[model samples]
Target chain A: GAGVSQSPRYKVAKRGQDVALRCDPISGHVSLFWYQQALGQGPEFLTYFQNEAQLDKSGLPSDRFFAERPEGSVSTLKIQRTQQEDSAVYLCASSLNSYNEQFFGPGTRLTVL
Target chain B: AQSVSQHNHHVILSEAASLELGCNYSYGGTVNLFWYVQYPGQHLQLLLKYFSGDPLVKGIKGFEAEFIKSKFSFNLRKPSVQWSDTAEYFCAVVSGTYKYIFGTGTRLKVLA
Candidate 1:
């Protein structure tokens, strides 16, 4: 794909439900990132992947948040026992290298009701 | 603990007016700075980035930002603005570990 693609542009889940969001990064991009953006706020880093290795996840909010980039290309962010505070826009981005320009996806808006 | 701060939460200007957005980061270590723009109903896009070159960096859409190491600031400026420039702007900082920390963001609205 020319740009990063994210699935489920919008999602509404009940409290305590589990939800999964997917991301397809640019072809052969070595770096992938996941972020969460609350309403009226900037995106916050959640996790990072260098190829298939999850090198950094210090920003993950809690144990309920888990992200995986299995083959270094596509990634998934799963939230277990979602809370109302978990409602936010989940963004996925990819970069050619660890330190370079990052291409962002449209983002998935998750609303936990 | 490194963090980014955007002073302005919202800005409104008329077309053809000059614009400036303030961004400051709290980090003493070596870092990279970036400015990103998010247009209406669009994903975030990189406007410009400052790595290890001149203090002044120019980006697409006639945007430029000056990195002042002493002040720990990277402020975005445009000599003249257009209606198309209306968008939400974000300032980001990347530390040695590659975690990109972003500011609160500023929403710009340009009236024709």
Candidate 2:
């Protein structure tokens, strides 16, 4: 597809288990972002990558959360020791550049039990 | 802490009603403002944006927004709304970096 796409539209994880969510941004997009959206709330910024370089990750909630875009096209967000609070929609967005409007993917909804 | 604020959490309106959703940001520097909408079971999509030049920006689905620098506000408006306009609207601000600070969002319900 031409738009951003994500895998496993839904995931349920047990406490202490680890989960990995994948994001495939639009082709040729130089800016990719990650966000977390809780029920009844807007998406919150998590991290951003300019190409292969992870530029800013100030919004990441914990050290256990890690994101990487080694090839600059596909990114992964991994969460270790899943907790109830970790249940939320993980959204990925990609833009032509840092200054352009981002196109989003149907987020992967993660549920921690 | 710099953040975006949306005035209403829920808005109930009838078809053909005029709509206005408020959004405000606490920032002093030059910034980019955007309004995004997410329909039921759909991804978030950009409605409009304000970077420079004219403050009034028109977006998809007959939606528009005005950027008021002095008030630090960018409110979305639609003259006549239809039932299809029902969705969750988010106001976001980007001061620097590529990341966006989004508001809690306003859920609008347009009744037919």
Candidate 3:
């Protein structure tokens, strides 16, 4: 794709439900990132991946938040037992390399009810 | 830990007015600075970036920013702004290392 793309532009889940958001990065990009942005706040880093290897997950808020890029292209962020505090916009970005400029997707707005 | 600061939480100006948005970062080593804008309902887009070379960097849409080493600042400026320029602006910094940090963001509303 020309730019990063995310699926399920909007999602609503019950407090205890689990939700998965998908991201398709630019073709051949080697770096991918996930961020969560709360209302009126800047996007917070979640996790980072270099190709299929997960290198940085320090920013993940909790154990319930998981992300994976199995084939080095498409990625998924899964939240277990979603909570109201988890309601936010989930953004995905990809760069050709760790030092290169990143391209962002439209983002998935998740609402945990 | 590294962090970026944007003091202006919200700014409003009339069309054709000059614009200046402040950005600062706390880091001791080499850094890459960037400014991004997110229009209503749109994804974030790069406005300009300063990787190296001259401290002054020019970006798209007549936007430019200066990187001041002593001040630890990279302030975005434009001689004039259009209504379309109204958007949420963010300043970011990546230390010589790979990790990038972003400011809280400043919302600019250009009155047409």
List the pairs of residues colliding in candidate 3.
none
DockQ of 1: 0.84
lDDT of all the models against the reference?
Answer: 0.95, 0.95, 0.93
Superposed Cα deviation of residue B14, candidate 1 (Å): 0.2
- Which stretches in model 2 have alpha-carbon errors above 4 Å? none
Give a tens-digit lDDT track for model 2, residues A1-113.
78999988999999999999999999999999999999988899999999999999998999989999999999999999999999999999999998899999999999999
Candidate 1 lDDT score at position B45: 96
Worst 10 residues of 3 chain A by lDDT: A37-46
> Any residue pairs clashing in model 2, and if so which?
none
lDDT of 1 by residue, A1-113 (tens): 79999999999999999999999999989999999999998999999999999998988999999999887788999999999999999999999988878899999999999
Tell me how candidate 3 scores on lDDT: 0.93
Model 1 per-residue lDDT tens digits across residues B6-100: 99999999999999999999999899999999999999999999989799999999999999999999999999999999999999999886778
lDDT, residue A85, candidate 1: 97
Q: Write the per-residue lDDT of candidate 3 for residues A1-113, one digit (tens) a residue.
A: 67899999999999999999999999999999999999888888899999999999998999999999999999999999999999999999999899988888999999999
Model 3, B9-91: lDDT tens per residue?
99999999999999999998999999999999999999999999999999999999999999999999999999999899999
Return the TM-scores of chain A for each candidate in numbered order.
Answer: 0.98, 0.99, 0.99
As a whole number from 0 to 100, the lDDT of residue B9 in candidate 3 is 97
Candidate 3 scores an fnat of 0.50
